[model samples]
Target: MKAPRLHIPIHYLKGVGPRLAGDLEHLGIKTIDDLFAYYPYRYDEYELKDLAEVNDQEQTTIVGKIQSEPLLHYYGKKKSRLTVRILSGKYLIQVVLFNRPFLKRTLTLGSVVTVTGKWDRNRAMLTASEIHAGEPDPGSKWSPVYTACSGISVRKLRALVKQAFIQYPDCIKENLPAAFIERYRLTGKREAVRTIHFPEDQEQLRQARRRLVYEEFLLYELKLHAYKQLKRVSQNGVQMNIDRPAVQKFIEALPFALTAAQERVVNEILSDMGAAFSMNRLLQGDVGSGKTIVAAIALYAAAVSGYQGALMVPTEILAEQHADQLDGLFAPYGITTGLLTGSVRGKRRGTLLRGLAEGKINVLVGTHALIQPEVIFRKLGLVVTDEQHRFGVRQRGALRLKGKEPDILYMTATPIPRTLALSVFGDMDVSTIDQLPGGRKKIKTYWVQEKIIDRVIHFMRNELEQGRQAYVICPLIEESEQLDVQNAIDVYTHLSQALPEFKVALMHGRLTPEEKEAAMDAFKKKEVQVLVSTTVVEVGVNVPNASLMIIYDADRFGLSQLHQLRGRVGRGNVQSYCILLADAKSETSKEKMRLMAETTDGFKLSGYDLKLRGPGDFFGSKQSGLPNFRLADMIHDYRTLTVARDDASRLVKSHEFWHADCYAPLRETLAESGLTQTVHLD
Candidate 1:
């Protein structure tokens, strides 16, 4: 069926004008299609009760007779109130409106009206902002409640929404195939859209929600599968027949031995590089899991073959750190290393570019500046991205385009659950370094209440006296005087005054890039004994000397974030510790904190975190660009998502349906959803 065309201007719609159209635009609604797809955050139901059966304090709607006109009373100094007496059979209930004296003109005595609002039993008053005259219609149940601004009430939005639906076009096209819908037990698109706004009953609402949620997850999975297929078919990478003897010599010369897990993953990466196709792989490891060594080994192999390797980091601090560390490691093998960042300028940058283009720099480490047009490589063979989440698809592609489609290796410390990883990075093969390096000690964790903050500070001071550095993290930068949680600035001030003898540095999201770098450098060099910061330090910057990490209001952060913060202190083997300060009264908060205290394993913690808080907290829907499903619970809906993945994979593999005309609408829908734009499938 052809979709109906409905393109009426907002002003032409019933009960809407220029002023209201502008308000609707603020909510991202500009067209009829937009209004139809704008789902409600939640719904409020008013139970119907007879006037005689109405009791004070019970939230119910009742039909009653207004015995007296609402009288407007001014109660001194900009205070006003409206009161009306209503007769409900033998009982008389007083209706009160606060700060709304205009209701007196709208409501009159001797009119039968139905009122719905909160009932205050102790005061014998029914406070209502929504009161309609005449008897309530039995069919007028399950009112559609919409999100509204300060001036726009739910009733007003509801009326506009109802008009939109009534004027909605017929024959809305179904994007999914008939066979797919039947197998998944999903409602048709037209019916789902109609029922979601004006459901016949609760069951219809549930079915509509299920259909839409399934469609979203299905489309997302399909896009991921398509990207994976395209990458496998199109890209032809150089097979690196790397010298294994060189790799073995470097490993033997190392101060430490490689773990079995690390060795296995490195071998797998090497095997992929040796294959005809280009390697697009992810190296996932927990904090302190020695991933950098594996990466360095890969770059070393590439360098030994007279090819250049590029390591791109998200931050200048991380790039500098990588360059410094790699410079030390590669110097023994007579390999030249160069650093490139936004801060590197003039002669230094020009010389580095010249060295790279001349094949003098064997290993290059930098931030996104490495992908700049001016930076050229003589024989770029491998591209390694650190903390892959910070770089988007375009940035990664730009780096690959720099040299002959270099084998891409993306590294992430954020241990994603297997299910979520499939959806987020399904295009790449994943290798997890589950084992930590030998001799790395687990950081002891403690959850303390705010009352014992003074004692905690004393302990931190003692640690500082022993030549140890500490990290104090806050959720926000400046103090929101209204909010009770500690901010970085406020904590910095308090810590400075409390520990007047020690040096303190403050860093937050609001700081300038140079200022943040300076603050981080001071803390890294031990110039600052304590560094107060936000989650900006969650990744990249590594200070092995910082042995203490104290997170204020630990309950405010997600489980994965708390784990990432704790990972910062345990980098060095100096018996590090993490202290989570939280409110003791909240049992839920205590439970989440206990999860952090029990284990130091990030992969296990990620799974438990997903189960405890649900997958919604894993990537933070806003940050991950993943759809937020209304009906599908990440924890409970994993089975459905997996099923959808399997079905999508099968459909794509079997070309029988790929060329079918039935899929044209589905393809068009995918294009409209912006999924196609993100995944540039060839």
Candidate 2:
């Protein structure tokens, strides 16, 4: 029978049986395409050197015929040695291998051997580090080393790949357009893949790798540019005549003046809203940098323009918190506000939903409940979603569908650098509130060992004695099946017992809505001196009385989460402290803790975290709305990304470029990527 295509399952191949295919699947080599895509992690180089050319104390690999069987000698119980000699170019080279006596059978006389080791000048010997009983290929200077599994060896994998290339050369055909490749001076896809697998030298490998990396960036940039183009078109949106004088008056009435960055972003949002098309923008700010205030300004403009506005947050606690703050922030301008959440239902929900539909509630603040099928806006002109990474693109789209493409503003507290933010979310116009409000207290952070648990508690007790509250955050709400981390309930119970003089309480995900609210309410009211909880409190929890936050196993959380948790404290003018207690004692954990203690700048921490955890992990959960790129490294390959972005822009704007036949493959690739669904506001 004819051989199956490269896309066929690996078991159909010559040597990969069902058992072997299962083993190969673990290395992400399920199909022939996957096997070809599996690039080597590193390379081993060997130079065929003669004994006469080899230096006395230099590391080298030499291939020659063995003169005799390896002689074995033992010293004491564990020490053993095997001495062998090889003849190369009429010169004799002494080789000594320690502890591996099994080589006596493989290194027998008349057998060709390859030995690599450091030469010992005094003994005129080359102490063997690795010995192969075969003549090394003279033409090849390097050997590819792939990531392997338990059941697979390097030899078997190399042979399988060689067989694949030889048998199915058609499978590695170049698919990119010829003209484009020539213009960019890029190698063909076929040549690139071949050179990547087995390059003649470093220069060849470099050229091949460059082509693949650039292609990865180009594809990603195309998707991003397409999303941007599709989203920028004019839509039948709610056209607003923003009252500039009234808006300026409202800003002046606020207790604190708006920062320069905040004023500029507000103007940008207002300009977009007044345009005929819908406004799709992202408001990125650091923790406590006053992003909500900027969002409120946009909502106020919409409300005063005789249209409804809605702000969606991530958690109920944050929803309630924003509603309370917005109620006060906008109340002076006679702009009414309402709250809608999962907790508000039945007649209350019915009445709230009715008020929203009738325009009685000018601005509605809530969690995801704002997008429920039952909820309706009378004349929705603005929609703002906070902590945008926590929600999926589909969920945000559902919210937008509630109105006629109302102006959308997605807010995130994670402080990504400007370049990366633009590259990742190229579909949306970015506005950053880089400056925090003036006179904010700088939070002091410290890393403490687990052995000083009592001392840490005593310090917190002192803060509590002075009429301040504290937060004790655990990594888990309850015992986890996989991890041995501290749980909130256990920590709460221990704290309550250890400090009977002060009221302590536990809050976690398992608690009912009312129970959770009650615990948070008590803590907010200072009825509970210490609040023990998981990351539930990371979303914009405003408790100024809480001055101390002690996170147990802080290494378990992401850098942004840790920053948000630290933001919980230092809200007021009082000095705040964040103590991280890590017990894992590993280098990774120590580095994480040290980074937390060293800097309070979220942007710097984010870059550092991205460097440590790769773009896939750093972008956050799948719900974060970041595309899964298989090759692009946003941190390291930024220059390539910039070039590709420009290339995509140039192509998209050029009518002649799109009309070419070479654009066929680009169009096909884009169709399969689902770029519209991945990044859309309507």
Candidate 3:
């Protein structure tokens, strides 16, 4: 079947014009195809009802005749109001409009008009900004609302959407197979597209959403699988047949023994590193679960085998922490370590670069500075990245090219669920460290209401009296001019004055780099008894002496982020405690906070976090490059995604599309869909 052609200009299509087309460009829409694909974030229906059926606080569309002429009244300097009276029976209903004096001229006595708005019972009035002269048809019950700007109305945008759908092609290309659609009980692509914008009823809208969600997940999984196959066939890895003696020596030198899970993961990584093909592996673990120790072992092994190793972290503080920790770990084996970051400059950086190029620096740890052009390695055999999600695919590729397809080990403290990992990272081998080292204490947690603020402060004071440090975390750095929320600066000032005997330091994202480094240095040296800041210290600021963490407005943060913040403490042998303070407004927020108070398991918290917040905020919106889908609800559409993934896998395996005649259109779709850039498919 031939596809239909669609052509429509911006000006002639309903309410849009040259001016509005520029506004639409902000949303990435330029043509009829783009307009049809712009889905609604949500839907709300106004049930049509008679004047007598309109109840208080219910949104309804009522048709009635004006019993009296509309009156205009001016209040203060620039305020004006319009009032109209409508009679259904003996009862006269008043409709009020504020700041719209022009509405009085539009309504005349005995004129029939349809009004849509909420009715208020206390004032016994119908307040509406939407009033039309003629009664709308009762059969046109469902109203399609679109997002609007200042000059554009929802009704106007809806008209434009209708015209675009009419101009859409007659036979849209089917991206999924017919059998797959039957198995999932999904609607056809062409029909779904039309119904999504102008659905006949609620049922049709639901079906359209299901079909689109399935298509999205199916295409995503297909591209991921194809990339995995290509990588496996193209790359080669170094074969190192060294025994496990180096790894064992490093483990024995540690003050504590490794957990069984950690030991198993270490062995798995070693096996991959010794293979003929290069290793593209991910080491995922919960926060403070001892994944870094395993990574250190792998680095030591590479160094002892006369090869260089590099560990790249996301932040300067994390890079420094890793350099310090590894320096102590490899001291006994006579292995030297060096640090690289934006802070290092002049002769020091040059000396570090010389050591690295001359093979004297066996192990190097730093941030993205390691990927700079001036930095060269003698024979880099292994590259390990901390918090791999923080870096982009292109950045990682650039780092990988520094050596001969060096074995890549990516680490992330964010505990992604097993099912999601299988779909998102299908191209990489996964190793999990699910255990903590011996002698480490689990941090105790508690959820307190705002009413107990005084008591929480009293506890913090007692901890400070014992010569211990604490952290006071706020959600915002500065008080927003519009919102009345607690900020870091205000909290810091109040704490400093309240506890004059103890020193307090403040830090936030708005601070200069030098100021931030100074604050961190002071906290590390024990010069500050209390550190007030944002989540900037979540990932890699290790101060074992600080034993208390009090998060203000904890309900505003996600579970994974809260877990990462709590991980800042509990690094040493001392027992730590965390306090979560919420305003007790939402039951959902209370339940999420209670879950955090019950356990210290990062993976369990992460799973529950996904169920509560979904995938959008799991790794944060910036880290995870998945575009926000309007029709696909990750929580409600999990089953559809599962079915779609299975169907796509089966079709790819059974059909000879890669080498057959019916594959040309599929190839074109893949290129035009932007999957080529997303999954890096050629």
Candidate that would win on TM-score: 3
Q: Between prediction 1 and prediction 2, which has the larger TM-score?
A: 2
lDDT value, candidate 3, whole model? 0.79
- Per-model C-alpha RMSD: 5.5, 7.0, 5.1
Residue 35 in candidate 2 has what lDDT? Answer: 80
- TM per candidate: 0.77, 0.78, 0.79
lDDT scores in order: 0.81, 0.83, 0.79
Q: Please provide, for model 1 over 1-682, each residue's C-alpha lDDT reduced to its tens digit, 9 standing for 90 to 100.
A: 2232345556667777788888888877787767777777665454566654656666667678999978888998878988899886665888877787767887887888887777777776888756777875565456666777766777777777778767655425587888888887899998898777767678889999888877767777777666666666665777777899989999899889999889988998888776767888889988888889999999999898777999999887788889999999999999999999999999988888999999999999998998899999999999999988788778888999999878889998888655567666756778888888888888999988989999999999999999999999999888686777899888999999999999999988788778888999999989999999999888867899999999999999878789989988977769999999998467767778888989888988877777777655566544444555645665566777777777777765556535577776655555554434322323
Candidate 3 worst ten-residue window by lDDT: 673-682
lDDT of 2 at 570: 94
lDDT of 2 by residue, 1-682 (tens): 1122337677866888888999999988887778878888776668777666767788888777888777999998988999988886676878999987877777779888887788776676888777787877666767777878888877678778888888766676464678768888998898888888888899999889888888888877787777666666534667799998988998998999999989989999999899777888989988888999999999999988998999999888888999999999888778889998889978988888888888889999998888889898999999999988888878888999999989999999887876568777757778888888999889999998878989999999999999999999999887888987888988998898888999998888889878989999999999999999988888888999999999998888878788889999999989999999887567877888889999999888887888878777877565444655555577887777778777887776666544566666675567666642322222
Report the error of model 3 at residue 431, Å: 4.9
Indicate the residue-level lDDT of 361 in model 2.
92
Give the per-residue lDDT of model 3 (tens digit) for 1-682: 1122343445555657788888776666677667777776544454556656667798766777898988889999989888988864455788888887877888888988877777876676888857777766454466666666665666666667777656545435676656667877889998998778667688998898888988777777666656655555465776666558767877897987888999888888888788777888889998778888899999988888788899999878788889999999997889999999999999999999999999999999998999999989999989999988888877788889889989999998887655466565656777887777667788999998868887988998998888789999999998898755678999999888888999999998888767887898899999999999998888868898999999999998888889999998887777788999887478889888989999888888888898888776675655544545657755567677677666656545544545444544454455554434222223
lDDT at residue 657 of model 1 (Cα atoms): 38
Worst 10 residues of 1 by lDDT: 673-682
